[model samples]
Target: MVKLKIGILGFGYWGKKIYQALRRIPECEITVVCDKRKIPLDNKKIILTDNYKDLLRMNLDGIIIATPNETHFSLAFQFLLKGYNLFVEKPLATSFKEAEKLINLAAKRNLNLFTGHILLYHPLIDTIKKILENKKNLELKIKRTNKVSQINKSEKEIIYDLFPHDIALLLYFFKKEPKIKEIALEKSLVEAHFLIDNEIKISGVWGKGTDKERTITFFVENKKIVFDGLLSVLKLKENGNEKIIKSIDYQLPLSWELSYFLNSLKNKRIKEKIPTLKVMAVLDKIEKLL
Candidate 1:
């Protein structure tokens, strides 16, 4: 099988992780990496570039945009017009209108577009989904927090950063719009209580300056599934019987996501694998409520 030559834009926080995952996938070859800083390259196979423009002229099958949230629109638009398949981190665009345009452009250009909702590909999530496949009702609760000594963004923007994972999970499980009932919002923290499809109740918390925590729990019909955000462990309890469902097998989510992205590009149907627009639409609605 031929490897897909892909260029990556942004070698910062998430970008570095994506780069590592790309190297692990035999189906992908990193042809170029672009960032403002002169990022060190360990592999001679990669052509490191500080200018993103160089990527436009390179022979590439796809481009992954792992840059900051604000740059997603302009950078993604640049590559989509160049006929490259695209992958972007969560919150694909800051706003719904911009996301809509990108999705439409991908459709018009016959290119594949994927968003980095890595949690969607996680094994714990997969286990929970299979467990809940037969259940009639669902309730969702997500808690995502981090401790930051310095303020990097506004409260609302922080909310944007932390909630995309939870929002993507909601869209996958409930497939309904969530309505916010109350929000205890502050510059350093955010909490929201909402309902999905008027049936599934969800309570969410996002804040910094605390012990780092990320956990999502589901409750229904005397059964509870708990996912440890940091550990990627799953616990299931039923009728007062507690059973640890699985050991943390430790599959890198980044690798799985890249494989899915590459397969979607090869198959020419991203909708069948991961529908990013729906996730973006859910994100947009959640942002408007705040």
Candidate 2:
């Protein structure tokens, strides 16, 4: 098997997770890792550098950008210009214009551009989509919370840090952009209400609290399906009876997501364009509203 030479930028919280997941993929050869700070790695075969430019010269098959949100555009632009395929962490860019430019550049160069919307790769998403298909008068309520102290200091505001996952799921489930009905922001919390297809209603709450929590609930007709992300379980409720419908397999979502990216590179075909422009557009609207 020919290993794909992959380079990653950023070695912080999420970046480290990407590295760990990539290590599990047999076809991924993580050639170089770049971070501005000193990152200690036990593996001597992998090159570690504080300067990202070192990666530009490695002739890598792809580069993963897990840097700060503000730096996503600049770093991705440089890598795409070098003709390397890119997998940028979510929110693709801070602004719609920047995100569009990156997409256009990748399309022009005939290189794959992927975003790290990890939740979409979760096994439960498929089950949820199947259960909600052809359903009417649906309502989605998602709440994501992180413990205040556990939250990464480098992360942006609540909306930018947590809302992309919710918005991406909304687009995936509805297959269209939702019309923003209202937005409310507080010191540690942000909430938004959306109307999908002028019928299905969506509400999202993101905030920092004492404990980590991630839950998504779908109300379709009279049946209710809820996904408890922390527990990796799905439950169904109907006729006053609730039962666990599905418990996800042992594989982590990050591992699955990275595997998909590497396999797509090997096959030279991408299954879906995640972190789509529509996702960025909704984020733009939310940022402006806030």
Candidate 3:
């Protein structure tokens, strides 16, 4: 088996997860890593650098940009231009222009490019999608809240940091862009409400300076599926009886995503794996809302 050389940038919360997960894959080798601050690594063979350009110089099979929202386009652009396969974290680009440009550029160069919409790869979500495909009169409601963290310091609002996960999963399930018919923005507070498809509602709040709650509820006929994001479990109710599902604590999904990207890279067919242009357009609208 040919091991692909993988380089990771950003080295923050999600970055570290990607780095650690990729390191365990037998078909993968962490060639280099970069971040704004010094971070310890399990393997000394992994070259750590503050300047991304330096790591970019190392001959690698792929590069994963888990950096800030602002630097996504530039770094990915340079790497893609050099014909390196890319695995970018969610909200592929902060702007539509950049997202569209990168999507097209990856196609023109025939390079593997995947957006890290991790939720879409979850086993429960996959099950939910399959169930939805066979059910009618299904109503989905999702609510998520994050703990008080410095990550939301982007000054972009909770929607940018939080909504993309739900939005991408919503689009993945709907398999088409739903018209965001109603939007209710709360003022003088830390929470906002949005109504998409006129049936589903998403309300969120952060920066409360206290404990947080993250949950998502899906209503289909007589069954209710509630997802506890913080606890990583699913609560199900049927005929007045309820059951709880505990999520497996593992990095299998992330590994699966990376493996898919590697296969796409070898097959030279990653452009199709990206969110459709229409989905990108809808996300652009939500980006503006943020």
TM-score of each: 0.91, 0.92, 0.87
lDDT digits (tens) for residues 182-236 of candidate 3: 4544331244455555555555443323346656688877788887665657778
Best by TM-score: 2
Q: How accurate is candidate 3 locally (lDDT)?
A: 0.71
Quote the positional error of residue 90 for candidate 3 in Å: 1.0
Model 1 Cα lDDT, one tens digit per residue, 108-161: 998887888888888778878888776666776777887676465676476557
Candidate 1 vs candidate 3: the lDDT winner is: 1
lDDT of model number 2: 0.85
- Expressed as tens digits, the lDDT of each residue in 132-232 for candidate 2 is 88887888888898888875432245655688888888889878888899988775777779998877988977886667889999987788889998888
Global local distance difference test of model 1: 0.81
Task: Name the 10 consecutive residues with the lowest summed lDDT in model 2.
Answer: 151-160
Better of 1 and 2 by lDDT: 2
Looking at model 2, the pairs that clash are none
User: Sort by lDDT, best first: what order?
Assistant: 2, 1, 3
Where in model 2 is the C-alpha error above 4 Å? Answer: 150-156, 238-241, 249-251, 271-275
